[model samples]
Target: MHTQPAPTPTHCPYCALQCGMQLTPDAAGEGVAVTGRADFPVNRGALCGKGQSAAAVLSRGVRLTGPLVRDPGTGRLAPATWEAALDAIAGGLARTRALHGADACGVFGGGGLTNEKAYALGKFARIVLGTSQIDYNGRFCMSSAAAAGQRAFGLDRGLPFPLEDLPRTGCVILVGSNLAETMPPALRYLTELKANGGKLIVIDPRRTRTAEQADLHLAPRPGTDLALALGMLHLLVAEGRTDEAYIRERTRGWAEARAGVMAHWPEYVERVTGVPVPRLRAAVGLFADAETAMVLTARGPEQQSKGTDTVGAWINLALATGRPGTPLSGYGCLTGQGNGQGGREHGQKADQLPGYRKLTDPAARAHVAEVWGVDPAALPGPGRSAYELLDALGGEIRSLLLMGSNPVVSAPRAAHVEERLRSLDFLAVADVVLSETAELADVVLPVTQWAEETGTVTNLEGRVLLRRRAITAPPGVRSDLEVLHELTARLSPGLEKGFPVEPEEVFDELRRASAGGPADYAGISYERLAADGGEGVFWPCPATDGPGTPRLFLDRFATEDGRARFVPVAHRAAAEEPDAEYPVYLTTGRVVAQYQSGAQTRRVDELNKAAPGPFVELHPRLAARLGVVEGDEVAVVSRRGRAVAPARVVGTIRVDTVFMPFHWGGAGRVNAVTNPALDPVSRMPEFKVCAVRVERVG
Candidate 1:
């Protein structure tokens, strides 16, 4: 009889929850099976619908098996050998650099990439391509929160405290995050909080599933979160609920922030935010009466043109309440993508280097250059952000290389971005499946998926966990590291010495490259992660034998003066407001069944059955005005483009706004109508709010 292989421990591929899971071979020995790991603290043996059915996406039949290149004669994609594809890409990039200079070569990365891949990609662009036009999809996900967090505390981590502290807190105010639909496994924390006699306050434009469970739900108008926060602060001041001692001891710049909030009285704020004064006052009372309170934000407030300032307002509220730096109380951003926290920390962003170091700093440049064995002066300066780089594609950036991201379905103003991709001189994409963006590439390389690869990813709580390889990839498929190594050899032969194909080797080098920086992951190793029994290790772990930090800012903030800074901010409308021609506000979000862009999850039959496609969610009054019944086709037209989906009339949403999930492609792609106006500080495109006109379609 043949012996069976031992089960391999890993984590889910979807969301930042990174719920622990164990993979074991099926009885028929064809593919693997997923089982929840009880040892993990984040999910605690609970798996959502997406996590339970994740193994379905690992089937060989639905995945790409070989490299494909566009046929010149037929103008169609056809299978090609690895040698031919790599040579073609190398020649294309070389020609672009030779004609338009090295700045014309753009590299776009994804938030789903492992820590090793993110580090290697950033180094590869600076050393081999010698270009600074490198950024990732995480810019669209959490750039605003990152900027605000860094400004307030002098450091940025998705969550400074662990999820295990949620139940112990006295109260939690969830701002604009629909955790029930976006991350179902994480919803248990709210349930447990209520079970522990903690109060829950949910703020959203619609009465979502997450909002339904709240003790008090405040439905503010779209893009008015800043005004709501300012109003709450004003009420706290009027009621004498502010923590004067904590403000004087642990925070700075509160006087200016206080004056800013006083300008917007409760009555004026009620007009701007469409939320009654009673509700606003009630929210403040619930939050202020608790011994320890917490505030958590997500994409809703972070995907706006004034996102950085908007998040700053929320942070000011938390600081005034004396929540941050206290046990079981603080402010945290609920990051969306799988590795969003780690992806931003270790470079792959336009203005950052490994270890969350600024690219413009000479010390950062010298430190990273020494690790890569290159001169600091040879490194290029910062370039355009994600949307800007995509917009510059046929013009300044002539050649492009993309990995993991499916921007055609996920980008703001996506139809125009697709046109930009088509105009590029040459485009190369590496992915496990032929995504909507990959379908437009001149060359497409098949790569190994999550279960077939070994790497590390950081969760929302700053815990760095290892994802162990379970099964071998197909014969023709290759890992991303191998693809990068081969491409480096073909493009710059001698420079390939430092590029390692093994994940372990690349991670070891990454540790050396990240020493002494703000993130400080120098002490984490694969052996240590595995020996932790799936609990994973947190960051700022500088010593090899010391316990990692699960909580931060206990004694003092990371700022130079050891106090959090409060930035005075005012409210502003969205970039595009509803007018006579476009009388309705449009907002986009995610669903529990389908992940971003629906690249891998759409291929799973179970997920497809649960969430078949997109639909317009609107109030019954608005549906009646448009003369559209349930399941009737409707067209939502913006200045940029139009998206058509079936209508679902409900009482949950506000009358002036409509909601749609931006997961599907083609006519159902909601991103085609999203605004591309970027925040000046964070450079994140405004995706949560845009003006559009609705019409009934036969």
Candidate 2:
């Protein structure tokens, strides 16, 4: 009789929850079967629809198996050898650099990449191509929350406390997050919170599944979250619920923040936001009355043009209530992508180095330079952000290397972005599938998928986890690390030390580079991570023998004076508001079955069946005004573009607002009409709110 090997424990590949799962060999020996991992603390054996269907994407039938190059004469992509593809990419990049200088070459990365891949990609861009134009899609995910968190606490780690603390907290004010749909398994924690006799206040424009579970749901007007938060602060002060002693001891700038909230009286805030005065009072009473409470924000408020200031308002509320730095109480951001927290920490961002160090800081540059064995002066400075880099594709950047992102379907003003991609002189894409963006590339290199690679990824709670390899990759597929190693060698032949293909070796170098920096990972190693029984370890572990820190800012903030800053922020209107031409508000979000961009989730039969296509969700009054029924097609026209989808007339949404999920392409692509106006500080696009006109189609 043949013996069966032990199942490998790993995490899901969908959202930041990173729900634990086990992969066992299939009976046919071609793929692996997935099951819930009960011992892991995050999810505790709960698996969502996306997690259960994740293994379906690992089949060879759905993934790209070899390299492809576009024919010069035919303009059609054809299979090619790996050597030929790499040589073509190297030649194109070199030619572009010789013609237009190093700044002409750009590198674009993704939020889902492992820490090893993100580090290698950033290093390759700065070292091999000698280009300063490097950034990733994570800029659009949680940059506003990160910028606000850093300013308020002197550190940003998505979540300051673990998920286990949620149930113990007396009250939780969840703003703009739809965890029931975006991350189903994570909703269990909120459920348990209610079960423990705790109260939940959910704030969103639409009555979503998450809001349905809340004890009090505040459906405020779109683009009015800032006003709602400021009003709550005003009510807190009126009721004398402010933690004066805690604020005096642990915080600074209280006078300025207090003065800012005075301008936003309850009546004035009620006019700007559609929420009633009584509901606002109830929300504040519930939050302020609890001994220990928390505030969490997600993409809804963080994807606006004034996202930085908007998030700052919420942070100010937390600070005034003395939530942060207290046990089981603080402000946190619900990161979207799988590695959104780690991807930004380990470089690949326009203005950061490994360990979340700023690129323009001289000491940071010198510290990282010593690890790479290069001079500090040789490294390039910061560059344009994600949207700015995409807008400058044809003019300043002639060539681009994209990895792990499908920007054509994800970026705001996607039609314009697609035209920019068409105008590029050369384009190379590295991905496991022939994504919509990869189809436009001159060269496409096939890479290994999640189950076929071994690497470390940091989750939303700042826990660094090891995803072990459960199966061998097919013949023509290579890991992103291997691709980067070969490309670095071919681009710079005379370098003494070459890029490492092994994930452990790359992680060791990453530890050395990240030591003494803000998001320090010096103490973590492959052995330490594995010994934790696949539960993973949190970051900021400075010593080799020390256990990682699961909660941060408990003793003191990371500020120079060891005090949190209270930034005074005022409410502002969205970049584009409803006007004569566009009479209604438009918002975009996700569904329960499909993930971002639908590049991988759409390929799975079960997921596709669950969410076959996109639809416009509107109030019954709006549908009746447009003379549309539940199944009738509706045309939503924005200033930038237009999209057509079937109508779903539901009373759960606001009458003046229309909703669409941004996961499909073609006529159903919602991002085509999204506003591209960026936040001055975080550079986040206004994806959550825009102006549009809806009409019934025959």
TM-score of 1: 0.99
Local distance difference test, each candidate: 0.93, 0.92
Find the candidate with the highest lDDT and give its number.
1
Per-residue lDDT, model 1, residue 634, is 96
Clashing pairs counted in every model: 0, 0
Compose the digit string of candidate 2's lDDT tens values, residues 1-698.
44566799999988998999999886567767889999999998989999988888888899999999999989999999999999999988999999999999999999999999999999988988999999999999999999999999999999988999998999999999999999988898899999998999999999999999999999887899999999999989888989999899999999999998999999999999999999999999899889999999999999999898889999999999889988999999999999999999988999999999999999999999888888999999999999999999999999999999999999999999989998999999999788899999999999998888999999999999999999888899999998888787778986515478999998999999999898999999999999978888888988889888899988899999999999999999999999998989999999999999999999999998999999999999998888889989998889999889999999899999999999988998899999999999999999999999998887
Tell me how candidate 1 scores on lDDT.
0.93
TM-score computed on alpha carbons, candidate 2: 0.99
Give stretches of model 2 more than 4 Å off: 1-3
